[model samples]
Target: MAETLRNTLKAERERLDLTQAALAERVGVSRKTINTVENGVFVPSTILALKLATALDRPVEALFQLDDSGVSPKQDT
Candidate 1:
């Protein structure tokens, strides 16, 4: 069985030098929402995931992925 959502959200945000509040603002969500999502306490809806991908200029799969190997993909940039 594949794992549930795996997130590189915090890493991706940091790569862009963005704070949680900053990312939240871009995605129209609260900082706490970003925090929870980062900490794996919450799974974002598809819309929010797409918003994040758009704001970060990445494919949603890069930030949120599912893999049976339990391995996170390496950053392309």
Candidate 2:
């Protein structure tokens, strides 16, 4: 089955005026990972997803979606 991970990371980060590096530091991940996530090249693990949502001050559901009608479907996570 396919899933759609819709993240407001870029939008939230920009709203907070934070760089990807800054977000990465807060989320305890490499900037490259954040870049991949923001670009939809990587789907974060559950823990990583929670960390990112926490850093962005949003709920996990706001950062990641599972339904098919939302963002484009991704290959498996």
Candidate 3:
């Protein structure tokens, strides 16, 4: 099985005019974590994902996507 993870964290936050610090405060994470997430350098855990979704007022699926592309090519195809 393969998975692809896509996040709209930065876009959504920007759309709402939220700074990374503000988002981190709302999500109970450090600003560095939010920065890492926005930069695609971190893949959040389920709990963190839920917190982000809650803070953004969006469903988890809207913020994250799991698809074939997330896996290695050997696993995906």
Candidate 4:
């Protein structure tokens, strides 16, 4: 099984009525970085994740979760 990092970045940013650029500026990152992170194109480092959580006033776990749907059980040979 694989644990993928799924996030609620888009939803959280929207809930705060913040544009990608605005959120990026607040987190000292570029808008592309925010977009990539939100769209799951990029996996943010722990530092970036913490910064995002802090800027959004959300807990790290609230922003991200581990999804195990990427793999399936092994079949008997």
TM per candidate:
0.82, 0.80, 0.79, 0.84
Least lDDT summed over 10 consecutive residues: which range in candidate 4? 65-74
RMSD (Cα, Å) for all candidates, in order, is: 6.8, 6.3, 4.5, 4.5
- TM-score-based ranking: 4, 1, 2, 3
Regions of model 4 farther than 4 Å from truth = 70-77
Clashes of each: 0, 0, 4, 0
lDDT of 3 by residue, 1-77 (tens): 53447688999999899999999999888999999987777889999999998888999989887656546566554
- Highest TM-score against the true fold, candidate: 4
Off by over 4 Å in 3: 1-4, 70-77
Can you list the residue pairs that collide in candidate 1?
A: none
Q: Which ten residues in a row have the lowest lDDT in candidate 1?
A: 65-74
lDDT of 1 by residue, 1-77 (tens): 54677799999999999999999999999999999999888989999999999999999999998645856679899
TM-score of 4: 0.84
| Every candidate's lDDT | 0.92, 0.85, 0.86, 0.93
Q: Distance (Å) between predicted and true CA of 1, model 3?
A: 9.3
- Write candidate 2's Cα lDDT for 18-61 as tens digits: 99999999989899999999888898999999998888888888
Residue 38 accuracy (lDDT) in model 4: 90
Off by over 4 Å in 1: 1-3, 67-77
- Badly placed stretches (over 4 Å) of model 2 are 70-77
TM-score of 1: 0.82
